[model samples]
Target: MADKSTEGFYEVFEVFSKRNEKTDMQYQFSLLAPNHEMALAMAQENFMRREPVIDIWVIKRSDIRKMTEEEKETLKRIDNKDYRLTKGYGYLKKKWREYEQGVLDENEILSWGEDKDATDRKRTTS
Candidate 1:
């Protein structure tokens, strides 16, 4: 006997779970299900029953758009252009080092947001 509900059961679902408070969610594995509800329940027993899970996401495989082998070939570009990155800006680092100055990194730039005095000074000056 053919079951109509089982026809869609071949649909794949990707399962993910958050292990703890400090860590981000990671992919567990894939499972087959008739619908999202079934997939979620099955995923819990199949993978997360013994482990800690803060959150879960059951995504339908058909809904996901993944790159194909042919498409990946086109995604490749020349790595010779470091001119677009900080590594390309290595000369500036050497220049700053020569003057006994620290290389300006992302942490220093973001720290500017924490400086209320700098913001107030800018507002007063401008």
Candidate 2:
């Protein structure tokens, strides 16, 4: 039989905070409390006191359902971000020859006009 003095198990709560309304809530820390009110208060006092936060949230750890490894893999497969890399953009060797210019390089393509002088000026020998 259970002891008369024994209390129920304490619930774990995960805290999330948003610096501003435009930003998404980020995981901050976890706290164990007997109820939601206490959890929110504890989270606010323990974590948010030092940091600047526009909003705060507290959710029960048991309520959260995590994605499986297979689901993670599926997301990886679906996200085809090769175009963001060098190889995905393909080599412009022939095109550069046709235009009588050097092939687009990493710095050149990524510069976004910041290196306008380098790109526009002809090579000089000193």
Candidate 3:
């Protein structure tokens, strides 16, 4: 059994990380620390000891405002919003074909940012 009064001192901190400059931040894991400074100091050692991380963020769990399942269900997308999706932009492929130009889709466009040598090696192996 632990002291109830001291419980408040150890706050939960959520860790997020970005692998490289071009990558988006992703949730890594969680830890308990007395304060933000201590949490930040411990974050790298605790979560990224063996991994390459470009950036790390430590957020106090109590400070986050999240929606419930019911609140999430309220969010909806209309079929008329097809222009927002890749399927809606499918016509661009045919249009590009007409001009004899390549139409790079989302994955292909993103892959352009990857290391060309690594990509070439993978293609050769495949």
As a TM-score, model 2 comes out at 0.53
Candidate 2 residues 1-126, lDDT tens each?
Answer: 545554465778999999877899999889888899999999888765597888889999989999999888877756778888899656677666777664577787768676765656644532
Clashing pairs in 3: none
What lDDT does model 2 reach?
0.81
lDDT for model 1 comes to 0.81
Worst 10 residues of 2 by lDDT: 117-126
C-alpha lDDT score of every prediction, in listed order: 0.81, 0.81, 0.86
Q: Which residue pairs overlap in candidate 1's backbone?
A: none
* Per-model TM against the reference: 0.53, 0.53, 0.57
Taking all chains together, the TM-score of candidate 3 against the true structure is: 0.57
Per model, how many backbone clashes are there?
Answer: 0, 0, 0
Model 3 residue 12 distance off true place after TM-score fit, in angstroms = 0.3
Query: Residue-wise lDDT of candidate 3 within 1-126, one digit each (tens)?
Result: 658998778999999999999999999888989999999999988656689998999999989999999888878654578887878887987887877655557877667767686888899999
